[model samples]
Target chain A: MSTFAEYAISAMLIIGGVFTLIGAIGLARLPDFYTRLHGPTKATTVGVGAIVISSVIYFSTLGRGIGIEEILITAFLFMTAPISANFLAKAAMHLEVRTSEKTRGQTWDQ
Target chain B: MMLTALYITIAMVTLAALLNVYRLIKGPDAPDRILALDTLYINAIALIILLGITLKTRMYLESALLIAVMGFVGTVAMAKYLKRGSVIE
Candidate 1:
């Protein structure tokens, strides 16, 4: 691989790794379920997307033709993550999970 | 340089997975645990893809894909069961 390609892949990997770590930290430390939801849905999805795109570039440059699998997974992930998050939040609401006092939304009755 | 970056990324992703596990174990609510498991699967997918890249093989891709499909289904099922009393009703 060319130096430019190597550099690009490295940068993508690093960005992906950093965002993933940040999202995990947010997930672990956030005060409530709703607030924690923000982390994995937004940050981790993008993080995985970036990393997969790098993989696509790497494999394509390796002369085996473009690997469409990575792209497909990224798309699939983007589609499913929000749906799962929505339902999980709904479940939390149904169960009357506690929310932090600083949270602005009023709790819903089951 | 590339090798070093890959090693660093792997370490960071592993750490992320560990944190997710911590959340999974320490959840104060069921949905919290479910969310942690969802995030953990996603992190596992990332780790598999990274390993594939590092080892320069495509075999890991299929496993990653399978995990993605199963993880989504599992999350949805568990979420439904949590929201309602049963997964199918």
Candidate 2:
């Protein structure tokens, strides 16, 4: 007796959960701050977007008129996460932690 | 079915929170810790939204919005401080 909304919500949650798990694993396993930025910035963005989409679906099904608030939050998060990560990475580079030896000669610091 | 989804979401968020904690503990620099904390707050906000759904309450969504705003402000302030030793600079 489950509705389409219910199925959609379940699928969204499951996908979001998987993305979150991958982000967490990357956060734990990445070797440095620069590398670690890859995890939360990328995976968490998609993960949170999925969750917010699920919320929108649920609320719309409940007749709440499409849950525009969740969409706004998701958009804001997507814009902010990468900016913050970039700021942190730039700050880290300014602080001059040694880059990985593998990247010694890349010379992209600007 | 909803309960099962709720449980799975909770577990995933908890694991995400733990991973952020691990980064905080092992971070070699202050900025690294700040970044980890920022990620933690985002995950926490998502968790709050999920909890609101599970509990069938709209109140938790307000808290999630607050957390989203405050977390972004906090991260920006911390990043500014990391760059210039003063959040305002």
Candidate 3:
């Protein structure tokens, strides 16, 4: 409700929104599937996490007790993102998704 | 000031979601599209939360939670199907 709280919320939202946009841009522009995977997991996770934290701050200061629901969502997201990313990477491997030649890595089972 | 910032955030997030849609449609691979789908849902959750803050209501929270759960399950299932050619084996 105070000006400082408003500013804090605004700052968090801006940071979160910008990172999210960058992640989506990476998704659209990256040449390799594996490279594309890095965008959402890294940037979007932080982005959404900040946004959720801001939500917690906003609601908690709104004269209510601390909010735990948003925290739960944030925790859930952090947990599942890596698992999903791992699965997607595995699927890409099984399907033999193309990789850019510039990619350098130890030999994978082909 | 806060309202203006909220509006800007909503615009930015919507643009991001649109970009995700472009990747979803233009995917050069199945996993690329799936990744786009996954990001889309995550963005949707962010949007819902932002909207809740803007509207000062808690009604959307449950839907956001449900989306998170369902979206993760869907991603895992689709990934498994892609990896093994069937979801259940």
Off by over 4 Å in 2: A104-110
**Candidate 1 lDDT tens digits, A6-74:** 999999999999999999999999998999999999999998988898898899889878877787889
Which pairs clash inside model 2?
Answer: none
- Give the number of colliding residue pairs in candidate 1: 0
Residue pairs with colliding backbones in model 1 are: none
Better of 1 and 2 by DockQ: 1
Interface RMSD of 1: 0.5
| RMSD each, Å | 0.9, 1.7, 1.2
Candidate 1 lDDT, B1-89, residue by residue in tens: 87888888899999999999999999989999999999999999999999999999988988888899999999999999988889989
Instruction: After the best TM-score superposition of candidate 2, give how far the Cα of residue B70 lies from its true spot, in angstroms.
Output: 1.2
The weakest ten consecutive residues by lDDT in model 2 chain A span: A100-109
Off by over 4 Å in 1: none
Lowest lDDT 10-residue stretch of candidate 2 chain B: B55-64
Ranking by TM-score: 1, 3, 2
lDDT of 1 at B32: 94
Q: Between prediction 1 and prediction 2, which has the larger TM-score?
A: 1
Please give the C-alpha DockQ score of model 2: 0.70
lDDT of 2 by residue, B1-89 (tens): 75688689879988988988998998878877987898899898789878877876666777777788899999888887877789764
Top-TM-score structure, candidate number: 1
Cα lDDT tens digits for candidate 2, A10-73: 8898888788878878888877677778898989879988988888777777776777678778
